[model samples]
Target: MKFDNDFFNTEVREGFEISSMMKRAWAAQMEVFQVVSDICNRNGIRYFADFGTLLGAVRHKGMIPWDDDIDISLMRDEYNELIRILPGELPYGFVVAGMYADCERLQNAAFVPQLRVIADEELWDFNDYMKYFHGFPYQRAGIDIFPLDYISKDKEFADMQKQIIKLGMEILGKWNELNREGSLDKFVSEFGQLCNVNIELREDTKNYIWKLIDKVSSLCYRDEADYVSSMALWIDNDSYKMRKKCFDDVIEMPFENFVVKAPKNYDEVLKAEFGDYMIPVKGTADHTYPFYGHMEQELIKQIRRVGFKGSVDEFCEEVASGRLRV
Candidate 1:
């Protein structure tokens, strides 16, 4: 199952276009990765590069050439500690962002926790809505930190868990529809009408649903389950699961100019997720992020639509304060 080195070698690997800007974005992510690694090492937290990151390590000895982001996963308990301590442990400009029960768009389950380290906004320069949508500043390059949770071996308990994830996913679909094309007030008004609720009550209901999803997902941790997956992505079967041993230990791998932790059994981890881990896909935009491009006027329009008529910093502040409402 070995791919020829020439097959993986390319001027462009995953259709990211290999520009200076893209290289800077990858560099920025690695900068954040280094900081995250330092914090985890100091606090004795366990984490490993996962998903495309692991693929990149196994195949390229670094970033997958077309890839621009870093992915890492921590087991449940280690994840909790990292989330709790990261805000204080990270340098002044870095922050961790995730869904809070009190935040707007609580029905949105599309994002997971991230360690967002500040980059020059001019460098990444994403649109205001992308930043506003996540309550992160435009200047931040985020390293995604997925939390792996145990899966119950019991059939009944597993069924219940799957149902909760299904319901949460359904709500996420609805949330995306309502928020896809509107100002914050318009989204609230439209969603309230759709749900037959008062506009004021819609947010509370959403937050409650999000809280339940979080609570249901956490229940598996108490059981002595032998398998784990990132339940935040709604895993319901063994296909997404791996032996807990896959993550119980680690080995460091070179990523660009620096070394980062990877699973001790990364070959098995990659094999489980991607059948032919070394094979290059032909002509795919798999590495491109949805929010990577932002024309200046489009960004301005999105900023004004969110009711902000100021700088990116001001817009981010409004979003962070919960005043922007989306």
Candidate 2:
């Protein structure tokens, strides 16, 4: 069906005024990308622009004007290398903020594996937390980095990995006995001793479990993919379908100036994941601030159209000082 009224169902596209904020954000994003790309190029880092970012580069030459995030991926070792090299090399107000697991908010699922440099603090605030998870810096608006692990493709590895998990679950039952209670740190510290118990009991459980951990760790790395971006804000099922329908056209697009790899099966992937990719689907957002002026513009076009009634000044004031104290 065409993108007429019936099929397009959703709230306004949201945060229309945020576009100004987004523009400032996009400029910052450009800065981060240039720096990161330079580092990667100089150090021979293997990187790729994946997911929405890739799609954006392919389609918009930069960030999809309406999207709020950016993602990039690197191979396992290269990811580690980036971690090792970034702390000392970053320009200013930016650094590889390290893994969020060690942070006080360990349980906040909103915190993704990689952090980005930004001035915002929250994850959903259109002006503040607009940027959820990204690579580098601890700022609110910035790019998120992802590490791709090479999962074992073989059946044996998969089987072993599963068995190892089973054995580990058994060990977890006794974790409290060794540690105070819910301390991942304690469990890991005592992991070696537990393995000995396995050998003394002639049980393959502990040994196998450790091996699995090692393998999974060595399976390269495991982190979010860079594709969690809003490359095409206008993508409805039909538009997404068009992507798959014309996979060959998914070529290099200008990403922060240069080009990066893009998905070849854009349409197919979206269709498979969301049935019809053209519908104005519900997106992840922070409801407190505001919403788009036209979420289902095409739909609203046919139905009752309510003009936006907000302003950027109402939500947040520009950083009048032109600088933030780190």
Candidate 3:
């Protein structure tokens, strides 16, 4: 996967280094793209550049100058194929996460049915900060792969679907807290306090939430809906619904001296999302967070103080149970 000579030479706004953090992030994102593309090609799956990735490929011929992450989307069937084969196909240190993934990394995190191709790496100084204070695992850098779920063309139903999934995610976050503490009673009491409703603590709540996610994501897939959405994004008065053709008929477009899949009718797709994607927007693009290859050491000391050398899930459990203080 040869990239253009200037592929890594993107300059960002003032106070940001182009050659250090930007270069590493670009290299990591491209590497992950190669892996994902290879697996898809080998296994007969379909995927395409999406969101800012699609905008960049069409408007700038590569990554947006200030953007450092990759975004792609896969239709329902192809998403299933990638999920089934990614575990064995990805090289060591990379993981395919989301609802279909069984990786330990997501075992205790909030559960959503979307997909993310993560490239795991060694701990950084910030890992200590995140682990102790935030209860977050060692952050990985990779592409955000969204699954295009079936959605209705009707505004009311589409909005309703978004609301349903949002509530499910809130419940999943509560479920993660329950898992972290290993205490249903603790979670139930907290949930009651938050919602002002009393209910018995039961394991079925988690199972039910999981099923609700499956059902909502499957709603459009089961029928021939006229629209589709990434379904992972939070709906704050924004609609992700795009015409079905934006996903069905794909065409390859130039991206950093290579070609990647994109919608055939990208004009309509882009217009629906961004009124004029061709024109450069005012000011520089904002930098995406959590890119790999940078860490601070003072943070590492804070993590080692915890004295726990187990999976991130276990460490979170300890923190939840008051055995370890962040």
Best by TM-score: 1
> What local lDDT score does residue 225 receive in model 3, on the 0 to 100 scale?
77
Give all TM-scores, in the order shown: 0.68, 0.49, 0.67
Q: In candidate 3, how many Å is residue 124 off?
A: 14
RMSD of 1: 10.7
Tally clashes: model 2. 24
Find the candidate with the highest lDDT and give its number.
3
- Which scores greater on lDDT, model 1 or model 2? 1
Better of 2 and 3 by TM-score: 3
Which segments of candidate 3 are over 4 A away from where they belong? 2-17, 107-113, 122-139, 153-160, 172-211, 282-326
* lDDT (tens digit, per residue) of candidate 2 on 1-326: 01122211222223323344444445456556667778877897766665556545655566544565667765557766876787666665444432422243321322333434433344333322222211112243346776544434364753453344344544544644644655544444445443343232222333334333433433422232212212112122212212212223334456544566544555554454445544433343333222223332452342223332333322222212222111
Report clash pairs, candidate 1.
none
- Provide the lDDT at 147 for model 3: 71
Candidate 2, run of 10 with poorest lDDT: 1-10
Q: lDDT tens digits, residues 1-326, model 1?
A: 11122331224646545643355456556667777889999999988998888888878888777666778988878887887787688775455544541234321322432323334343333444233223333345667787787888886887677776655555544665655654444544444453344555354555545445555666775356877877755354458778787887789888666777889988778877777878865333344452355543565677888677787545644554466644
Model 1 misplacement above 4 A? 1-17, 100-138, 176-208, 234-238, 282-290, 295-326
Per-residue lDDT over 130-229 for candidate 3, one digit per residue giving the tens place of the 0 to 100 score: 3322233335656777777777657687667776666656656666676677875664545444334555656445544554565566566536677766
Q: For each candidate, what is the lDDT? A: 0.62, 0.43, 0.63
The true-versus-predicted C-alpha distance at residue 265 of model 2, in Å, is 8.9
C-alpha RMSD in Å of predicted model 3 compared with the true structure: 10.4
User: TM-score: which is higher, 1 or 3?
Assistant: 1
